[model samples]
Target: MTNRAGRTGTLNEELLRKAATLQEALPYLRRFAGEVFVIKYGGHAMGDDTLAKAFAENIVLLKQVGIHPVIVHGGGPQIGRMLERLKIHSQFVDGLRVTDRETVDIVEMVLSGSINKQIVSAIQLAGGMAIGLSGKDGALIQARKLTRSKADPDSNIERILDLGFVGEPRHINPDIFNAIDLDAVIPVIAPIGVGKNGETFNINADSAAGAIASALGAAKLIMLTDVAGVLDKDGQLLPVLTPRDVLVLRGEGVITGGMIPKIETCLDAVRNGVGAATILDGRVENVILLETFTEHGVGTMIRRDDPADGEGG
Candidate 1:
């Protein structure tokens, strides 16, 4: 009788914990209702089956809660894999893939065709309505070709190297989203833009997401990355950061390597009218829920230094 009673007690405790979690989420639900959240979903999370399903479900949950979600996805690893399979030579300068005419075609095929539809299917399977679109659709994102300059170590001479078909977002058309019923359907976007002269350009997913968030004036811009938020020198997560803090961290070399671009994206979003930007570790299950709904967030939140700008978070 005692053993049965203990088992029943444990079940009750579990139920109570779940109830408490719901209770904690109540205020956040009220606050974020009717707000748009632009999420940059990528990294190891997109590659893993279980994590992909979890991400899709979380996005659906956000929609169910009345928060509109717009997704911008990255497929770097997938693109590289495709390039290798096709026997196409690929090169990277400063982490941006040098996309000649041939490689850019392959890039668009992987990013807009396969990866975009896969995410849409995942979301649909999770009981949500999802529409997949690339930057080219509806003139969503107009882009300019990107060029890089490298300085000679000994001569200190700088020479420009054109990265064919690699581009940065020149403009984002807000009107395209104005027609969508964001309350009902989620838009999954591929970071593939078109130039003015009808040229297709491959864009960086993080930069595209930041530009979209800024153009939409989204309430939150969340980046789902491989690492645990922004870590300090000791490898501890910094829960919250301001623009000033980011500058200081960069100067200190605490924010280095690939993290630099992610942090810069977050900073750009917050600086350009997005309410708040966060970098969350996509490895964690239900990380978006933990970051948005819970009081103690699970990632690094970047907001304006002013208290008034900390509205959505």
Candidate 2:
């Protein structure tokens, strides 16, 4: 009889803790109601079946609670795997894939055809209406070729490298989002754009999500990465940062390699009027919920300025 009583007590404690968590989330749910959250979902999280299902359920929960979510997903690993299977050689310049004409076709196939629909199907199976789209659909993102200059180590001279079919967003047309019923549908976007000459260009998913968030004036732009947000020199998460803080970190070299571009995307999105931008570890189960609904978020959040104007956590 004592063992049975103890088991019931433990179960009651767990139930109370769960209820407490929901109560804590109520304020955030009310605060962000009717706001838009643009999520850049990628990394290993998308490949894991359990994580993918949790992500879909989170999106559905957000919608059911009256917050709209727009997803921009990356497929670098998937694209590389496909290219390898096809025996196509590829290279990267400054971390941007140097996509040739043929390579761009494969990128499009993987991103728009397989990956996009996969996410949509996951969300639909989780009991949400999800529509998959590419930047070429409805002229969503107008892009221009991205050009990079590399410094020659010997002569200290900069030389331009042409990354064929690799493009950056020049403009974002958000009218396509209006056609969807935000109350019932989520949009899963593939980062393939159309150039001025009607050529298909492969866009970086982070950049595309930032541009879309800015154009939509979203309340938040959340980037799901593999790492635990931006780390300090001591390797601790910074939690909150301003654009100036990001620039200082970059200058100090604390932020390097691929992280620089991700930070730049967050800075750009916040400065361009997205309320705030976050970089969080997508590996955590229900990471989006923990970041959005809790008092202490799980990653670095970059804001345009100080949170003195009744915004930001």
Query: Number of clashing residue pairs in every model?
Result: 0, 0
Model 1 lowest lDDT segment of ten: 304-313
lDDT of 1 at 189: 99
All candidates' TM-scores? 0.97, 0.97
Full-model lDDT for every candidate: 0.94, 0.92
- Residues 1-313, candidate 2: write the lDDT tens digits: 4799889999999999999999988999998999999999999899999999999999999998999999999999999999999999999887889999999999999999999999999999999999999999999999999999999999989999999999999999978988878777899999999998899999999999999999999999999999999999899999988878887888998999889899989888887888999999999999999999988878898887666622543
Residue pairs with clashing backbones, model 1: none
| Tens digit per residue, CA lDDT, model 1, 1-313 | 4799889999999999999999999999999999999999999999999999999999999999999999999999999999999999999899999999999999999999999999999999999999999999999999999878999899999989888999999999987898888889999999999999999999999999999999999999999999998999999999889989999998999999999988888888988999999999999999999989988888899999997786444
Off by over 4 Å in 1: 1-4, 311-313
What are the clashing pairs of model 2? none
TM-score of 2: 0.97
Clashes of 1: 0
